[model samples]
Target: MIYFDNAATTKISENVLEEMMPYLKENYGNASSIYSLGQKSRAAIENSRIKIAEILKIKPSEIYFTSSGSESDNWAIKDILNKKEKNHIISSRIEHPAVLNSLKYVESKGIDVTLLSVDEFGNVNLDELKNSINDKTGLISIMFANNEIGTVEPVYEISKIARENNILFHTDAVQAIGNVKFNLKDLDVDMMSISGHKLGAPKGIGILYIKDGTEINSFIHGGSQERDRRASTENVASIVGIARAISDASENIDENIEYTKDLRDYFLEKLLNVDGIILNGPIENRLPGNINISLKGVKPQTMVRYLDMFDICVSQGSACAAGSIEPSYVLSAIGRSEELALSMIRISLNHNNTKEECDFVFDKILRGMKKFKK
Candidate 1:
């Protein structure tokens, strides 16, 4: 299968799986226990945390593990809202559903939320962000990079405004972890969220980074874990898997960027010229592996099914909301009409995807496009 839905999830690398094997076998033990077996698991989890922290240039204590990016996102927003009696927060209209839904739930509780509008390229207007801040605003959460359209936000500037105003900043970096390279230590953001599955690690593992002394409440009440920030038995194996994947990805980060960018550009150069194809997002500023397009006059779901018949995997939008009859809210937020939004599809690349795979998938998509020609 030519899997172009990598923004949904990636194939776990053998190295990551290899790192997980020991914990899944004889090393299995609760990290909270005091016995030697448990100590081993605890050590592994802490080591992985330190490794991930080192990669991001943050302190080990700042890293909190969760089941998924959604969990991290929900926890961060909820914790912040519940901690202080603050009633206002800010986020982009183009955020992942994880953030959007969490805000929706809290909005019912009398808290104020401002979903800032993005430009046609899916980038949040920094001026709007600056204008939105008020004394009641406790936090500002915006994604570092968009999943559907792949537009990287100017988060450094956002962080600056948040910091200057004494408002906390959080970014959901789920799709930016391995695909985009940056030093988190340099950014003034208070928190960031990452999902292991989006890169090379297995599912059911994610990370949240909270800067030192960031005022946040705990949503989970259980045994002491994650420095008393998150409460749950650690998934030791998945922790090691995610840590190793990040480490490996960082080692060849430049190569990954160059290779995937070349393939994505090549693919778009060929595909965009086709009649009725309209490119989404800012082509120059988008993620190297992301290619979103709208086939004017074709239903995205129809094209998705047609491409799948050839074993080429792509998607209409996020896997989290796939198959929903509603038009893509991300597309709509970026000014796409309902019909144009419904006709949009995403083609996310991966580190391992090759030119040959692109060529093969291109022909299949060409045939599918013709078959659905208006």
Candidate 2:
């Protein structure tokens, strides 16, 4: 099967799984236990933390592992309440549901929220963000990159704005972890969230980077794990898996970017040859492996099913929001009509994808367009 849904989740690397097997079987123990088996698990967890921290150029103490990126996003956004002085938050309209829904939850609790608008290409307007900031605006949570459109936000500039205004900044970097090149230290964002499954690890592990001195309230209570910040029994195997997966992804990122960009461009070029095919997101500054487009006369779900018939996997939009009857909010935010939004499909590539596969997908897509177009 040709898997074009890497943005939703990636196949776990064999090397990562090999490393995790020991913890899953022989070394299975609670990290919080006082025994040696538990200590082994505890040691593995810390070692993974250190490796991930070194990769982002931050202290290991600052990294906290949670269940998933959604949990991380929720924790960071909810932490705003801890700062009673800061009653307002600024985010964009194109954020993943994790952020948008969490904002809605906070809004229910009397916290003011201002959703900044994005351009047609899904780039958050820096001018609008600057104009929206006020003393009451205590937090600015924008994604590092959009999941559906693959638009890389001006996060460095946004972080700088937040710092200047003495407001905390948080970025959900789930989709940006391996695809985009940036040093977290230099970016200087106060909080960032990453998920393991997006980068080749299992789905049960995630990390929230809380910079030193960024005080936030605990997310999960009843335990002393994660330096007492996040509470849970550690998933030792998945933690180790994430460390290995991220290490490999980070080390070979440059090569991976070049390879995926080549495949993406080749596939996109071929797809654009079809009449009435519209590309979403900016041609420049987008993720190397993401290709989103709307086939003017076709429904996205129908196209997805058509592709699946040939064992080729694609998606309509975010997997988290799959099956919703409403059109893509991301596409709509970028000024797509309701019909165009419903026509959108996302083709996310990875290092494992090849030119031959792209060719096959393109051919199938053309056939699908002909078959399904209204």
* lDDT of each residue in 181-291, candidate 2, tens digit only: 887789999899999999899998998999999989898998899888878799999999999998999999999999999889999999998998999999989999999
Give me the runs in candidate 1 sitting further than 4 Å from their true place: 83-85
**Cα lDDT for residue 163, model 1?**
87
| Cand. 1 Cα-lDDT | 0.90
Clashing pairs in 1: none
Local error of candidate 1 at 65, Å? 0.8
Q: Per-residue error at 279 for model 2, in Å?
A: 0.4
Model 2 lDDT vs. the true structure? 0.93
Clashes per candidate (backbone, < 3 Å): 0, 0
TM-score against truth, every candidate: 0.98, 0.99
Q: Ten consecutive residues with minimal summed lDDT in candidate 2? A: 78-87
Error of 2 at 178 (Å): 0.4
